[model samples]
Target: MSDKPLAPAIEGWHTMGDQPHLIGTRCTACGTYFFPKQSHYCKNPDCDSTDFEEVELSRTGTVWSYTNACYEPPAPFVAPQPFEPYAIAAVQLEAEQMVVLGQVVTGVDTEQLSVGMPVELVLETLHETDDDIKVTWKWKPVAA
Candidate 1:
């Protein structure tokens, strides 16, 4: 359990150890779905209404892209490192037509990663501070 604030943007990723889910908002008029859930406005560009409601995103998706972070990202991301490489990946939520990116788990084989490979969400620990811990969502290959 990370000491991080429970951000709604990552509700599914940092789970209570259950199936993970992302937050989303569906435009009632245009039938468009947005991740990070737009609660006030529609971004369809086709809809002119300001009505939106929050919904849970699909738990399952596919790997859209992947890479490794060889160097530390600039400040605000608090992970002290000797700069060991870490895997980062983008997952595509088919149901929402959206993508979410995060750091993949360590000690796993990533060479098999391919676009369109099935993945499931997981709660990933980012870093811990004295005052707060930060957590984010991640995706990995689904188990048989």
Candidate 2:
């Protein structure tokens, strides 16, 4: 990796630090949270208000489901050479109760994870380019 400072793989989606949070937008009317943040019309049927504000979502959640990715992903994604298989999980946020999917941190696998197990948000290297070390949020067991 180049000497460039660490940067987010996808800007404006999550923050960087020892404690990171997914940046989501909440509807001002119904208090509904959106992951890929919605800035346009509110999706809540009962609430017509279009106003929204960006909020840092909960950094901890429980494993709702998980699976192993044994094949290389296709398209715009950058997969490391040798195609290392990894475990991915859908965790339900503590407060929002919405499931957000992400790759589990390296080393831990499906056998080591179970539903309802607590996990926390963490930053990990997604891929490296000559420009910078692209970092993204990942879910890892809270005890690990």
Candidate 3:
């Protein structure tokens, strides 16, 4: 087997890197942007265009909201055997004018986060098996 890590948990969202940015689609008709990409059509209600272009979303954004998960998540979400609470954040990408939700980097608790704080995208291991490791993107608070 190859040594490279397995494919991302969610495909077409981002690529692994020291400075990873979310991949999204932008409408050439009305300038609307969408995360997870809308390959078929633009999401804006006023726009009925099917033309779109792939673009890398901004790396930095302000925290729009946040919360801490004090309990184990539902199935499909694999937590460590000895479960620990984790924080989730809704970050607003400035240029895109959209908010994307993701888990916060380890060690950042609800007490240490605030709305409007700057955050950046990061790649982290979600789970691992004998053959490969699953990776996902996360949000981390940016140092001033």
Q: Which predicted model would earn the best lDDT?
A: 2
Question: What is the per-residue lDDT of model 3 for residues 1-144, given as tens digits with 9 covering 90 to 100?
Answer: 347567677777897778988888899999999888897977788999999999999998999999989999887988887988989999998888899999999899999999999999998877666767777889999999
Scored by TM-score, the top model is 2
Cα deviation at 64, candidate 2, in Å, is: 0.6
lDDT of 2 by residue, 1-144 (tens): 467779999999998999999999999889999998997888888888889999999999999999989999896779999989999999999788699999999999999999999999999999988888999989999985
Candidate 2 vs 3: which has more TM-score: 2
Clashes of each: 1, 0, 0
**How far in Å is the alpha carbon of 102 misplaced in model 2?**
0.4
Q: Of the candidates numbered 1 and 3, which has the greater lDDT value? A: 3
- Cα TM-score of candidate 2: 0.95
What does the lDDT come to for candidate 1? 0.71
User: Any residue pairs clashing in model 1, and if so which?
Assistant: 12-21
The lDDT values for all models are 0.71, 0.92, 0.88
Q: Which stretches of candidate 2 lie over 4 Å from their true place?
A: none
Candidates 2 and 3 compared: the better one by lDDT is 2
What TM-score would you give candidate 3 relative to the actual structure? 0.93
**TM-score to native of every candidate shown:** 0.81, 0.95, 0.93
